[model samples]
Target: MIPLIEARGLVRIYEIRKGPFSRPQPVRAVDDLSLSVMPGETVGIVGESGSGKSTLGRMLLGIDRAQAGEVIFDGRQMPPLHSQQWRALRAKMQLVYQDPLAALDRRLTISAQIGEPLDIHGIGSKEERKERVRELMGAVGLRPDQAGRYPHELSGGQRQRAVIARALAARPSLLICDEPVSALDVSIQAQVVNMLRDLQEQNGIAMVFISHDLKVVRNIADRVAVMYLGKIVEEGSSDTIFQFPRHPYTKALVSSVPVPGKRLQGRVILQGEPPNPAARPSGCAFHPRCPLATDICRTRTPELRRIETGRTAACHLLANDLAVAA
Candidate 1:
C-alpha cells in the first residue's frame, strides 16, 4: 500500500539578508530529508531546538515551499501556495502551532475563529456552520457556551483546545503539530496530549508530531525519528529507539531523559552545541560529538541504511560495533 504522506529528498533553504552590498547566505534548514507516514499512523520527530523538525513539519503541511524536492500526499503532488491545486489540498491538510495564542486571532470570537475555515471552504450554510463549530468545540473538549468568549478569556490549555477545534473544523486528513504542548504547564500538557491521541483514534487521521521532548513523543508515537543538524540520524519503532538505541546520538538523547533511581551504565553525554547551518561540518554532522566516530566518519558522509527490522541509521559504524544488545 502506498504511504499516506511521502517526502523524498526534501530540502528547504532560507536566504539570510545581510547589510548593504553584502551577499546573502543560504542556510540549509532541511537537508535532503525523506519520510513516509502510513495511513492512520502517528510518526514522532524529535531533536534539539534548531534541528529543523518544525521546518519539516511546515513543509509537510504545505505551509512552506520546498527549495528542492517534492511532498506528495495520497499520490498527488502538493501545489505551491495560491495555486488551484493548493487551494483544494489545503482543505485536507492542517497545522496546529506550539503557541495557540499566536495562531488565534485575539480580536475574533471563538465561534468566528472556528467558523471562518468552514466558511472559506464553503462547507455548509450559515446555520450548519454554527452547528459544526459547536460540534468541533465539543470534539476538542470545549463547552459549547465557550464559543462566545475571546482568546484572552481562556487559559493556555483552553486556548490550545480552541486551536485544535479550529483545525478539526476543516476536516483535514493529516494534522501536523509543531510543538503543540511545549508552551503549556506540565500538568496540562498530559491532558492535551491525551486529547490528541483520542482524537486521532476516533478520526483515524494521520499525524506528524514534531517536538523536542522525547518523553511526550514516546507516549503518542508508533514510530520515532531522531534528527541532528537538519538530517534524520536514526528512525525506528518507539520501543526500539527508547530501549535499544543503535546510533550514538540516539543513545545520548535517550540518556538525558530523567529516570528516578535508575542509572544507565556508560551513558554518553553529547558534547558541544550543533554546528551552524550556514557552515555545517565536512562529513557526518554528528562526528563532532560521536564517541564512536572513526577517521572515515570525519571524511565521508554516511547514507541512511537499513540496520535491522524496521530500523534505519545513518552511521559508518553500522558494519561492526553498532549492534545494540537485546
Candidate 2:
C-alpha cells in the first residue's frame, strides 16, 4: 500500500539575528531529511534534545513551513501557506503538542476547547456540537461533566486528554504527537499512551510519534527513525532498530537504555557536542564524535543506504563492511 504521509528532502531553517545590524544567520533545525508512514502505522522519531525531532514533527503537521523540499499527504503535495489548498490540507492533518495545559486556553472550558474546531468548520449546530464535545470527552476517558470545568480545574492527565479530544474533533487522517505524554506522571503517561494506541487502532490514523525516550517509542511505534544533527541517521522496523542497531549513534543510544540488574558496557557518548547548524561539520555530521570514523568519513558524507532488509543507515563504516565500530 502507498504511504499515507511522505516527506522528501524536507528542510526547515530558522534565521537568528545576532544583532539588529548583523546579518541573520540560518540555523538548520531540520536538514535534508525524508521519511514516510503507511496508513495506520506509527513511526517514532527519537533523538536527543536539539536533534530537530520536534521541528520535523511541526513541519510534518504544517505548523511550521519548510524552507525547501516536499511534504506530500495522501499522494498530494501540500501547498504553500496562505493558499486555499494549504488550509484544506491542514484540515486532514492535526498536531498534539507536548504541553497540554500550555496549548489550551486557561479561561476556556474543556467543552469550549474541544468544540472550537467543530465551530470553526461549522460541522454541526449548537446542540450537535455540545453532544460531539461530550462524546470527545468520553472518547479520551474524561467525564462528560468535566466539559464545563476550566483547564486549571482538571488534573494534568485530564488536560492532556482535552488536547487529544480537540485534535480528534477534526477527524484527521494523520496525527503528529510531539512528546504527547512526556509531561505527565508515569502512571498517567501509561494511560495516555494506551489511550492513544487504542484511538489509533479504532480510527486507523497514521501517526508520527516524536520523543526523546526510546523506551516510550518502543512501546508505541511500529517503525523507528533515529535522528542526529537535524538528519535521520538510521531507520528501520522498531524491533530491528532496538535489538540490532547498526549505526554507531544508534548503538550508543540503545546502550544508554538501562537494563535491570546488569551494568551496560562503555557508552558511545561522542567527545564534543553537536555542531551548530550554521557551521555544520564537514562530511558526515557525526564523524567528529564517531569512534569508527575513518579518513573517508572525515570528508565524505555517506548517503542513507539499506544495510539489511527494511533497515537503512547513513554511515561510512557500514558501507564496505558489516562490522560497525560501536
Give Cα-based local distance difference scores for all models. 0.89, 0.88
lDDT of 1 by residue, 255-303 (tens): 8886778676565667888667777787898888877777998999889
Q: For model 1, what is the error of residue 117's alpha carbon versus the real structure, in angstroms, after optimal superposition?
A: 1.2
TM-score per candidate, chains pooled? 0.95, 0.94
After superposition, candidate 2 runs with Cα above 4 Å error: 260-270
lDDT of 2 by residue, 155-230 (tens): 9999999999999997889999999999999899999999999999999999999998898899999999999889
After superposition, the stretches of candidate 1 with alpha carbons farther than 4 Å from their true spots are 17-21, 260-267, 320-326
Clash pairs of candidate 2? none
